[model samples]
Target chain A: MPHLTLEYTANLGLDADAALLALNHALAGSGLFEEADIKSRAVPLHSFRSGTAATPRAFAHARLALMPGRDAASKRHLADALLAALSAQVSSPGLETQLCVELQEIEADCYAKEYRHG
Target chain B: MPHLTLEYTANLGLDADAALLALNHALAGSGLFEEADIKSRAVPLHSFRSGTAATPRAFAHARLALMPGRDAASKRHLADALLAALSAQVSSPGLETQLCVELQEIEADCYAKEYRHG
Candidate 1:
């Protein structure tokens, strides 16, 4: 199972639902996960400071959590894909925005998931 | 720096802001992270399916991301602490809910952060 979370500064005036759908579609389109198994959500940050105080900037950070085993190259590809989707769907025009995507491997031994959405 | 994110089902009718604060405080109180370095946010899922469709249930998942290097035991402690905080602050009454906490270490070589909130 892959869970992708996008957190964006609230001031950007982006639609969280649309962003989530875009990223979820991107992940599913990558053929990296089953469409049904992909879980994506977005959070808006009302109070966040990014870059230097001299310039008011915005940021969107995505964290992809998946089971450990993927090769580094594949993970990098996933991050890049997610980043592209975020930039296209979530980034606001006329705003200095920094976008980040991080891939984190969840250790199987320590991780536990019980899905009952059958 | 550590970033903790809580993703909960929207049907639970929980307060996302309170949960974020509780989790942030828990992480800071653990003394494992500086108060200023702990960033926590919550996302409420409006559309989600958990377990069997026969029973409508909810789930709250927390992913803790930190720089790689903490030992297994320490990470377990952190997870337990986080789970406790989430259960205390976010779980709704009269709903069958599942709570999960996962610690994912960010590979230092691949991770990058640029904070300007000074």
Candidate 2:
């Protein structure tokens, strides 16, 4: 189960939904996950602070949570793919935007889910 | 840096911000993290699907992202604490609520931030 969450600062003028889809595509293109199983969402951050200075900053952070089992190398590969998509999505000329992608292993034993169809 | 996010269903009878504060308190009480450095937020899900049946379901899932170095026991302790607080906060009569707490380690090298004070 790959649950992708993209949290971006409000100052960043990027379409959060589009950015999420792009990142989802990047994950899907990696051949490591199924497009249908990836649950993606975006959160637009309005109030946030980073570092020790008020020199104006923005960021887009994405966290991908997946079922535990992937090797370290494969995890890094997924992280790389997502970071690139997030970086490109929030790229701005005059704004110093920090982008990060983190991977978390969801415990298969503790995780539960169900699918309902109409 | 420890970033915490609590995602829950909107139908749950709970104050998002209040629940976030309680969770923050739980994490702070763990004595494994600094209260000031804890960045926590909540996302209320208006539209979501959980299981195969439409019998109504609710959940409160929290993720804690911290700098790597904690042991398994310590991590479990933190998760347990948060889960307890979350369960107590989201308890309702005749409603099935799923609760989960996952811990993630933040790579210090990849994380960037700035803080400004008045």
Candidate 3:
């Protein structure tokens, strides 16, 4: 019952690989996820500029599918940890000048491709 | 713990108001939601033409945040109901042609704006 999707705006300077690695590290060994269940995708957004005063940046949306036993507390912990890891990439941190994080839960039958094949 | 999001490509003929009303009607008396907590935004996408053979159509992505008491079964029912309502707008439906439905879990403190104020 735990599937997390994160939508956030990160600075242009942050390396995608580094950010992804950091996300993986934060999610690793949480005892709440299976080995291959975690799925993620990086979208380099340069066109639709809604937030951050129309700056040309990328919004990386990551989706993590975990095992179905975590409660709200554990989900919040993982989501917060993921955001903290992501925002740490910035040289300076402030409430007004940090990346945004929105997390969501995913259902087991939500993935059509996975469900149809396996 | 019910947060449902539906992202799908509808034909150019579908009216936004009708679609939104259909959504609202489906979730009106679900008994799983707090009235004012349901938030939605209808984006008429015309530029991003990735699916449907590059047709100039809109992709409506709706987000529904419900109370923290509904379980997976209830959540799935709500999500399926929402999609059925959405897809019903189309005159014809087929397996190869339909909008997408993605459901996620929402923690109590996931909404930053809501959490900071109340």
Candidate 4:
């Protein structure tokens, strides 16, 4: 399973849900994962600090959690696509924005889940 | 830098900020990374879907963005501790809750950032 978390700063003029949708679409288009298999969400970062800059700072970083199996090139392509999608959707006029994408390998054996219904 | 993002369902009876603080404290206590170096945040999920259950379902999932270097045992220990910390913090009486922790490796070479002031 691949879970995508897109974190965009509040200062950045970007719609989180819209960006998630677009990025998810782009990822699905990569022919790696099915559209339905991808679970995506947006995290709007409110409180943050960064290096000194003349203008205000903002960022939109996407982290994708992937179960172990994909090769290096496949992941690289996916990450690059996500970054391009973020830059396209999150660019503002005056804010200093940093865009990033990271791929996380989830150890399939160690992963655990249980429903505690109480 | 290791960035921690904790995502808890809206129905979960948890204080987002307090849980973040406690979890960050727990991570720092591990001696793996300094408290100040851990950039932490919480995302309250308003919408989700899960399997059929008699009671309402809720979850608290933590994803840590870690740069590659730590061994398997070290990462496993960190994830287990984080899961325990989450369980201790976010528990409600009636809802079925699932707690999970995921460690993601951020590739050093592929990571890119640009501060754009425009």
Candidate 5:
């Protein structure tokens, strides 16, 4: 029940190669995690801006299958650390940033490889 | 904890308008569900077959935020029904298909509307 997925507007000054590298580093620096069970993906959100549609927004989505035994205290601590790492890496004060973290608590039987023929 | 995300190769016969309509209808026929919390998305996967890499595969991804109160028995019943509906809609017996369902169990503090700037 500790899997987490993070979805945010893309291209928000956070997609640059340099910024992404820094973010990955921050994630690795956190000793509470391992990438063995974590998988993250960044999806692009683009739309047209005509007249009164306000400014455009970008988002990124990260899906993480957290390791087992993550308690309430540990989750909060990890979340705060992640946000801090992201903030330090992004460094864009003018853009409106949004971070949404969802902790997936339940899981059923899932196979790493497709058992179609078997 | 019943949120389910289904991902498969795209461009299968199920992508046809008629097939999708039938699938949605079948989902609605199940009295244990509501569209308010169920959200599904389909992404296409296409690649060229130039050598002995075998035939092409199509997949679909459905993300369903299931309504609460789905117990073990209820989930099994629902999964069977959903699979039956999909099979009935996609009648291509020759096509190799795969069905993977995951139950999302845990959720943390999540706001439908971003509480940014507040």
Candidate 6:
């Protein structure tokens, strides 16, 4: 299972639910995960400080956790795709926002997942 | 910088703010990140499915993203420490909760960070 998490500053003026949907779509479009196995969520940050003492800015960061063994090129592509999707969906007018996406590999031996549905 | 993210079912009845603090403390205690550079956040999942189609259960998942180069054993230690801290802070009374912690390594060459504080 690949878990994609979006963490954004609350000042962005974007809907968290919409952002989560965009992220899930991006992950699915990347052909990296089954639609049912894709776990996406957005966490809004109300208290955050960014930039220099003179210029405060907003930031959106995404972290994708996938099982290990993906090649570097594939990981890079996933990161770029996710970042682009997030920026398109979350950016607001007249706001300088820094967007970043990091692809992280979850070691299979140390990872555990259990699913229950009712 | 290591970013620790906590994703849990919202029904856990735990204070998200308190859970975040406990996570920050656990990460600092692991001594893998500088106190100033550690980023911790919690996301409460209102809609989630676990186990089979009969037993609806709650789950807490923590993903720790760190810079590449940490050995497997060190990663395991960090995961155990984080899970213990989270379970202690977030578990609900008389609820069946599955707690999982995954350690992920961010590929260094493709990772980027920009900080601005005012």
Q: Chain B, candidate 5: TM? A: 0.57
What TM-score would every model get versus the actual structure? 0.61, 0.59, 0.45, 0.58, 0.49, 0.61
Candidate 3 docking class:
incorrect
Q: Each candidate's DockQ score against the native complex?
A: 0.14, 0.09, 0.07, 0.18, 0.09, 0.17
True contacts kept of each: 0.08, 0.02, 0.07, 0.32, 0.10, 0.18
* TM-score for chain B of each model, two decimals: 0.90, 0.92, 0.65, 0.88, 0.57, 0.91
| Two-chain DockQ for model 4 | 0.18
Clashes in model 3: which pairs? A1-A68, A105-B104, A105-B105, B1-B68
Model 2 per-residue lDDT tens digits across residues B1-118: 5777788887888876567777878877888875566666677888898898977788878988888888999998999999988887885566777889999776544343433221
How do the residues B35-77 of candidate 5 rate in per-residue lDDT, one tens digit apiece? 3222223333455232465664443444445435668887676
- RMSD values, in order shown: 6.8, 6.7, 9.5, 7.7, 8.9, 7.1
Q: Which segments of candidate 6 are over 4 A away from where they belong?
A: B1-6, B11-59, B63-99, B104-118
Comparing candidate 1 with candidate 2, which one achieves the higher TM-score? 1
- Per-residue lDDT for B56-107 in model 4, tens only? 8888789988789999999999998888888888967787778999998777
Per-residue lDDT tens digits for candidate 1, residues A40-101, read 66767888887557676888899887888888888888888888988887646777888999
Residue clash pairs of candidate 4:
A93-B118
RMSD (Cα, Å) of model 2? 6.7
Decoy 2 TM-score against native: 0.59
Evaluated against the true structure, the overall lDDT of model 2 is 0.75
Candidate 3 residue lDDT tens string, B1-118: 2344444333434666677767767776676665555555555432222221222223333446554656777767776777777766644222223254555555767555533455
Please give, as one word, the docking class of candidate 6. Answer: incorrect
Docking outcome class, model 4: incorrect
Off by over 4 Å in 2: B1-64, B70-118
